[model samples]
Target: MKALVFDKSGLDNLRVREVPTPLLGPHDVLVKVKLAGVNPIDYAVVQLIPVQPMPHIPGAEVYGEVEDVGEHVKGVKKGDRVVVYNRLFDGSCDICLSGREMVCRNGGIMSVVTNGGFAEYMAVPEKNLVKVDLPPELSASLPVAALTSYHALKEAEVKPLDYVVVFGASGNTGAFAIQLAKKMGARVIAVSSKPWVAEFSDHVVGYDQVQDKVREITMGRMADVVINSVGNAVWESSLKVLGVGGRLVFFGGLTGSQVNLDLSTVYGKHQKIIGTTGGTRKELLELTELCKDCRVRVWRILPLEQGREALEWVAKGKDGRIFLKP
Candidate 1:
């Protein structure tokens, strides 16, 4: 099997090499990766996360077909089309029991702790796979990115007619955030520096306004909820644009993580700062339904061997999700 291996040295150390195929556990499913989703974290992890072992395959989300299922697996079988939740959790953990599995203290993300989706095949826990009937119109390209957006919106408690501001609106997560916010009946304000994003702003239905600058668009009154995928660079401004009692959901730190947040306004304005990670099985299911119904549009697709190229694009802050077809 061909896999892109990452080590402590950085992406320069990444190599395309033959590797042994994964062996399945009793409760695992063996998936033939049709497509894998690359996140900014993939790049960051290469630099920041210490290499656990040589030849680490770093991918978190995958859209694939089940090639084989363990005897203990009941929900899916061979030939099933599925989307996987990258965050693997111990079923008995308190967080898992309470349905907040993504935050399970004992179980973190797949790419960070275990072999991930960027390969010809991956063995994942059966509980983490969500079987869906893939729609002809919906390709594997956008599922993970869409699911991330869906998770952020649900966590932020976005309400109809609420003023929602999405920073980095041109990027994959931001693009979906814009569309999802609109679907939830929120008046969206999308911010992006790239001129090409104008196409998205023009076509996507719910954005009330699109701008290169945040302050100019807000016109003094901030949004009720601000969805930020770009960290540090927009952190201060993101908080600045939030109205009193507004919610700010942070999903990624693409820019950098160190930001000086003013704790004063948080108390005085009754503002809430929330952090969200991956989506739950229920959210993924709902997202699948939405995509199937033509409520969400997939952005684009790339091949799995283009993993390095995709990471480079993400590092440069390219617009839209880049799918890696295995």
Candidate 2:
């Protein structure tokens, strides 16, 4: 099988070459890749995450069809079109049994902890796959971005009439945040580049004018729920504009991970600083249902061979999500 494999961690190290197909296990399913979502984290996986063996394939979210199923697999079968949950866990663990599989101590993201779907074929655990009635394009992008945004909103406990501000709204997860917040009847303030804006957001502001515009729109109330993925870049501004008793959810660190935190402000304002990773399998299912026919704009689509170039482009930043068609 032809795949984008990296013997070392870096974009320059990535190469498309022939590799042996993955063998299926009794509790695993073999999927023939269709469309795979290329996240900035994919580059991190290739560059930073350590794997015992060399030649790692880095595609975190995949939408594919079942080429084969393991003997122990049930509730799904051959030829089933599915989405990979991307997180693997030991089912007997305390967190897994409590249904918070996203944070399972024994689990890690598929592409980072193991070889992911940057190839023609890959094998995944049966429990990590979810069936979705979606087109191949949506099947790829929605699993990660939509799932993460949905879970973040759920975690923030957004309610109707709440003022939701999404930083990096033009990016993958942020775009979904705009749509989902609006769908749930919240007034959405999207902070993005001047030329970029999603049709669903109630208000749009560029990074330069985020705080001012948000204050104007909310009449000094500021944001009730603020979702931020960009780290230090939006850190101060997000905190400045958040209303009293507000919530700020942090998941991605696309800008830079390290940042300064003010304990006094947090306590005085009674604000909540929530951190989340990926979405649960249950939330992925719900996200798919809510996103049915929902318009999600793709920045670009490249073939598997262009994986290296795709990583480079993603690094420079983009108006929306990018995916790989395998």
Candidate 3:
């Protein structure tokens, strides 16, 4: 099998090379990779994270066909179309039992801890596979991008007629945040310069205009929830748009991680600042149903061999989603 591999922690080290096919565990399923979604975290893993083993394959979002099923696998059979859950968890863990499997104490993420779907094939536990009705290209992105936004919105507890502002509204997670907020009955204020953002959001404005526009639209009440997936670049602005008692939800730091916060502002406004990571499997399942007809812009689809280039695009903050075809 040929896979995109990095023997060290650097984007420059990534390359496509022949490797042994994965051997399945008794409860594992071998998936023939069809499309692997490229995300910013893939770049982060290459540059920062210390992944085990000398050589590592870094792709967390997978859309593939079941090539083979292990002896104990029963839910899916050969030729079944599936999307990888991407988050590896043990069902017996305290967090898993409490329905927060995304943070399972005994678990680690795919691609980071285990070799992921950046190859001709990948072997994952049967529990990590979800059968999908959508096309492989589209479903490939849901596990990470859409699920993250969905989880953030849920955390914010958005309500009908609530004003919801999404920073980086044109990006993958941001676009999904706009659509999902609308679906949840909240009026969406998308903060981006892109015209496509208007298709999903009730209102669209550039970052420079977010504060003034949000104030006008909400009639001075401000936003009930602010989704700031873009990180510190817009952190202060995101906080500025939120009304008293509002929730500020965040999951990514694409621009920069560090930020200065005035503690008095949060307490005075009764605001809640929450941080989230990968969503639970339960939420992913719900997202599959809610967003089955979802449409995402595919910026490019390159062959698996061009994995390095795809990572570069993600790191550079390109528009639309990028996929790797294997």
Candidate 4:
């Protein structure tokens, strides 16, 4: 099988090369890759995450068809269209039993700790596959961005008529945040560089004008929740927009991770800062249903051979999703 594999710790090290097809265990399913979502985190996986034993394949979001299944795979069979649940977990663990498999102590993320689906064929456990009714393109786009956005909003406890401000509102997770907030009955204030977010948000403002716009829209009460998926670049601004006792939910940190937190302001305002990453398998299923009719902008769909270029395009910060057609 041909795949985008990186042998060392740099984007420059990534290349398309022939590798052995993954052998399935008794409980694994072999998937023929159809479309794999390209995330900025893929680069981070290659550059920082300790992808053990070298020659690592780094694709975190996958949508594909089951070409074959291990003997023990009971729920799905050959020819099933599915999306990969990128988190690895032992189903019998306490965390898994409690439905918080995303943070299982014994589990790790796909593409980071194990080889992922940027290839012609990949083998995953049966529990990690979710059958979907959407097209390959849309299904491929959801596993990372949409799932993360949906979980963050749930964690923030957004309510009807609440004021929700989303930083990076035009980016991957941010775009989903805008639509999901409105869907949940919140008045969304989108802070973004592009005007396209205006289609879904109650108010759209640039980062420079976000504070004032949020204040005006909420009539000085400020935002009930702020979703800052952009990270350190918008940390201070995200905090500034939240009303007293408001919740601030953050997931990815595309703009560097380090940030200065003011202890006094947090204590005095009684603010809650919540941190989350990928969501549970249950949330992923729920998100797919909610976004079934949604169509996201696809900037490009390149062949698997152009994996390096796709990652470069993602690094340049485009406004739409990118996918690899294997």
Q: In candidate 3, what are the lDDT values of residues 1-326, reduced to their tens digit?
A: 99999998887888899999999999999999999889888888888888865699989999999999889899999999988998888899888999888889999999889888899999999999888889766699789989999999998898999999999988879989999999999999999988888888899988887789999999999999999988899999989999999999998887998999999999999999999888988888887799987779889999977888888888777778999997
| lDDT score for candidate 1 against the true structure | 0.75
lDDT of each: 0.75, 0.86, 0.89, 0.89
**Residue pairs in collision within model 4:** none
Clash list (residue pairs), candidate 1: none
TM-score of each: 0.88, 0.97, 0.98, 0.97
lDDT of 3: 0.89
Residue 155 error for model 1, in Å? 1.9
Models, CA RMSD each: 3.4, 1.2, 1.0, 1.1
lDDT of 1 at 146: 76
Q: Give the higher-TM-score candidate: 1 or 2.
A: 2
